[model samples]
Target: MKLIDLNRDGEIGANCHYIQIGSLNLVIDSGLHPKKAGRRAAPDFGPIRGVHLDLIIITHCHLDHIGSLPVLLREHPEAPVVMSTSSRMLVERMLHNSANVMVRQKEEANIPEYPLFTHEEIDRIAKRLTGIPFGQAKRIQGGKDDITIILHPAGHVAGAAGVEIHHKRRQIFLTGDVLFEDQRTLPGAKFPAGRFDTLVMETTRGITARGSEKTRLIEVNRLIDSINDTIQRGGSYLIPVFALGRQQEILSIIHDARKFRRLVDCPIFAAGLGMDLADYFDEISRKTKHVRFNRGIIKELQIKPTPRKLNPGEDPQQNGLYIISSGMMVERTPSYTLASGLVGHARNTIGFVGYCDPDTPGGELLASKPGDQFLFKACNVKTKIKARVERFDLSGHADREELLEFAVQADPRVIVLTHGENEARAWFAGQLAEKLPKTKLIDPVPLQTYQV
Candidate 1:
């Protein structure tokens, strides 16, 4: 098989891959860079420009994975897109939200090439996107070659999947942003127990070592304690989350805490696309049994929408829990704006519960020490970091050791790493070399082709 990493800048931005097995041509994931804008954010499809794509496989609905789907479909009009049934249900909503965000950015950030694809284009392309049931093998043909594709549950989010492809006597698996440990709202991954010819995996948390004592339950309790302490101290708690998965997961977790009477009696505020996605998740849970979310959680928790007109560098004084979007706390986002005000107050707390890119505002804040001056450039606010900033080990991605063990057990002939920073990938490269000495490890340079 031959493969090319289509991501332009590499380092976990714009995830796109093109590969060929026998006579088949396939592309897996067409994602936009979370920190990049305009055309540069999209994958460099120049290598596959004239190559007729036989299939486009999407692993999930996160913007970083599916944000560029419409753009890719616009270019390859005939290639059919396939994903797990749950992802199919969520993809359009996620893409529509992306288009809406791009439209807003076009006006606010003055990007003329924003709204890369319109709503109409999404509607037109929706007909070509099909959702296949998990564990069901679908035979796809290209030229004289045919391969059977099966999607396995990847427990990162509600609709995430790990792709398994069988071509002739060879088997290949691609772990797309996976988490093997279960969470409050979802179960852990259920990958097949077997060997494979090739393994492509995500090294998202490879550089971060997990402490033996910091289990999920312990982290959950610590988070609850932190929130209770913040609220008791008359300060608000902010958990910036990814709307698609992390928001829902955090809500479910908070709901559990409240049900057990472990949480303090404080008003909970949450708003944004995540609240709307709750309804979608509820429907999915009822229909597919793949997710476990209920829209009634909002009503029971008495969740309130975030106030629309929030002043920068001024505390809202809600003294409640605020769960908002832009997990990375990107500039101009609600989390970033609220963080600006909260960071200036010593009583408040900002707790992170998911992965943050180092270049993003969230990661920068995490790297800073207390009393350091932090800047909210988008809002033109600068203040001393008096607030308590904490991070919990509740990330959606799998742990480094867990991922390493999975790859080592697979015992594949070749291993390809994707969706991580240089340091993270380097750690995995070093560990895999030491553990699986003979396995060919290929970290493809962006836009370069390699035969495996």
Candidate 2:
């Protein structure tokens, strides 16, 4: 088999991979980079310009996985896109939300390539997107070669999957953003128990260690305790989360706390695309039974939409809990603005519940000292870091140990690493080399093809 990493700049952004097995050609994911803007954010598809893409398999609905689907489909019109059944229910909504965000950014940032695709285009292509059930073997033919495809529950988020491919007598597995431990809204991954000829996996949390005390329950309780302390001190707590999975999971956790009377009474504020996704999650829970989110939680919690006009460098007028998006605190996002205001006060607190790119504002702030002078450059707000900045061990990605164990157990002849930074990949490489000295490990550079 031969493969090419199409993520352009590589290391966790614009996750697109081109692979050829036998006579078939496939693209696993086509995502837009979170850091880059406009057209530059998309994966460099120059290598496959005239090449006929036989299939495009999506791992999930996250922007970093499926954001550029329409863009890719525009070029490869004949290719069929397939994902897990749960992802199918959420794909259109995710793409539609992306289109809407792009339109807003086009107007706000004055970028010409903002709305890379439109709602009408998405509507036209939605029918072509197919959903397959887990463990079901679906065969596709290309030329004289035929291969069987199976998707397994990956459990990083709802609809996320690990790809299993069988061609001739060889078997292959691709771990697409996996999480072994169950989350409040979803169960843990249930991968097939067997060996494969080749194994491809994500290394998102390779650099972080999950200490014994940082388990899910402990982190959740700590988060609640922090919120209580912040609210008792008369300040708002800002929780920056990803609009898709993190937001809904946090809501469910919060609902559980409130129901048991463990959480303090406060006005919960949430809005934007995530609130809209609650409806979709509710439907998925009923139809697919893969997730456990209920839209009714929003109403029962008396959650209100955030105030439209939030000022930077000035604490919000209403002191309550603010659940906002752009999890990494990307510049110009609602969480970024609110963070700038809340960080200058001692009473307020900014809690991060998911992974943050080290270059992003959230990561930079987490690295800073309490009294350090922090700057919110996009909003032109500079202030001392007086507020409590904390990170809960509630990341959506699986821990390094869990991932390493799975890889070792698989005992594959070839291992390919993707979806992690240089240091993270380096760590995994060293460990894999130490454990499986004879196994071939390949970390493909961006857009380069390697035979394994």
Candidate 3:
């Protein structure tokens, strides 16, 4: 088998990998980089431009894993796209929102190629999608070199999966952005048991030494206390979250907290694509029962929607909770806009619930000390950091130790690590070297192919 890394940047953006086994050619994901724009956001498709891919499998609906899908479909219209049923329901809306974001960027960022793919194009691409149930093995190619694929729940988000491929006599496993522990909305991963000849995994949280030590219950209680403290001080709280998994998870936590009287009754507001995605989550939970979330939680909590644009000099703080998207607080996003107005207020608090790229606005705010002056580039506004800034370890990815333990248990002969920065991959590699001294570990070189 031959494997190639297609991500232009070595980090966690534009996550695409190509694998050629016997007569089958497959691409694991086609994602766009959240930190970059236009062509730069997409994975490098130059090497596989004319390659006839038999299949493209998307493990989840996150933008980083499915954003550049239209580009790939445009090139290889014949290749069938496979994902979980829940992912199919979410990807349609996610891609449409992505197109809208790109269109806005055209006017805001001066990118001529903004809206890389139109809604119409996405509609066309959707026709090629084939949703499959978890644990069901489906054959794609026939004859002696037949290839079959099975998807197992990966637990990062609704419909997220780890794929197992069987070709001829060999088996390969790909652990797409995975989380082993359960969240409020979803159960923990149900990875297929046993070993494989090759294992491809993610190392998104390997850089942190003690990331896995903190349990979800502990973090949730801490967040509850923080929110309670902020509200008790007559201040509003802001949680900048990703529209998909984190939003729903946070909402569920807050909803339960209020139900148990752990949190004071306050107006809860959510804006951006996350609100829309939550609706889909409710639908999926009711339909499939795959998610443990109550469908009526949003309505029960009476969560309000923030207006598209706040009025000039408007005070968003009514001593309530505001949940907004662009998890990294990308410039011009709802979170950034709301934060600009809230940061200077001494009584408010802004809590980060997930991973933030060090270069994004969210990371800057988190790294800033209280009373520091910070500039928000999108609005060209400067504000003092009077509001409390805190980050909770609510990461969706499995912690470094958890992931290492899983890898060790799987015991694959050859292990390939992807979807992490250099430091993170190095950390995993060092640990693996000590834990499994004889096992072969491969850190892929971008645009290079390796035979395994």
Candidate 4:
């Protein structure tokens, strides 16, 4: 079996990895890098040039993991893209949103640009998707060989899964993006019964050390306390959040705090698609009260607000708190607009909830020093640094301890860590090498191919 590196660098996008076992070709996670300053960057597709992939498996709906799929489908035309039902729903939303951005960027720039794919390509890929649930095994025919692939709960996102491939006498496991007992949304990853020959895992948060889940609630409440203190002093609280995971987690936690009056009663505005998604999640929890669904507490927090929705020319003095989406403050994004409006205002605080690329506006906010000033383009508001800027490790990704625990449990003959920067990847690899002396720890090199 041969493993090919697609996008060895994590977070930047264009992560395309391929696995070849005899006649069967398995392509995993064809994705694109986020656009910087309105320009879309391409992922490294060098390893897939000479061969045609028979099957494509996506782990989740993050644009970086599935963004390149439509183009790949447009080019391949015959390969089946497989994912979970929740993932399909998320993919549709994410793809359409991304396409809209590309179109808008093109029109605004007046530059001749190629959209990742047409709506036709999206429709075709949607049709080609085989929505497989967790714990099911699918066999793909490769003209000369048969390959069995299994999807196991990854707990990263609603439909994220850890993929396992069984071919001949060998087994390979690929963890797309994992939530190892963080308990943000889904349950922790389910460990497969048996061992595997090789393991491919993503290390998006390898550099960060996450606190215990028990402390997560404490930290969240602490942040809320600070926000409350600011607001009680006649300040506006602005929390820039990721539209999906982090936003939901924060809502659930704050809702619990408010129920017992631990936190102040303020308007928790769920703006953008994040609000809709949160509502959908609450509905899902009501239907399926499974512990796997962390909706029990959230269900109680779903009480109707007093209709505080805002519009153009609306007064902002009425609400005390605002939670908005697309965490990264990019131009034209709702969170960006809001942050630009709130920044440099002494009475307003903007708290970042998730990862932010350095070039984006959100990243800039994260990089702000304690006393530095920030510019708000939308409102022409110059906010002072009086509104506190703080970050809690309320992340979905596994930390060092979690990574070590996972490596020990999922012990394989060889381990390859991807989706992290150089320092983080190296630290993880070194840890594995020291702890698991018998296992061969591998760090992915850009476009390199290794036989497993």
Q: Which numbered prediction scores highest in lDDT against the true structure?
A: 1
Residue 366 Cα positional deviation in candidate 4, in Å, after optimal superposition: 2.0
lDDT winner, 1 or 2:
1
Task: Give the total clashing residue pairs for model 2.
Answer: 0
Candidate 2 lDDT over residue span 147-242, tens digit each: 999999999899999999999999999999999899989999999987889999999998999999999999999999999999999989999999
Among all windows of ten consecutive residues in candidate 3, which has the lowest summed lDDT? 307-316
- What would you estimate as the lDDT of candidate 4? 0.70
TM-score of each: 0.99, 0.98, 0.97, 0.88
Model 2's TM-score against the true structure: 0.98
In model 1, how large is the Cα lDDT of residue 87?
A: 94
lDDT of each: 0.93, 0.93, 0.88, 0.70
Candidate 4, residues 1-452, lDDT tens digits: the string is: 78877764544566678888889888888787765322245555655765788998998877778877887776677788998656765677777766776777677656356476666668667788877867878998887999888888777666777888888888888888887665645677775855778888877776776545536567776787877887787776767776666677777667767777888766566556666676556644454331233444445654333234433222366446777766776655666666654554566777776677666767777788766776654434454444466666566666667767777777789998887777778778888988889998777677777866
- Residues 1-452 of candidate 1 have per-residue lDDT tens digits of 99999899997878889989999999999999999999999999899998899999999988888899999988899999999999999999999999999999999899899999999999999999999988999999999999999999999998899999999999999999899999878889999987999999999998899897889999999999999999999999999999998999999999999999999999999999999999899998998888888889889999999999878898999999999988999988999999999999999999999899988999999999999999898899999999999999999999999999999999999999999989999999999999999999999899888999
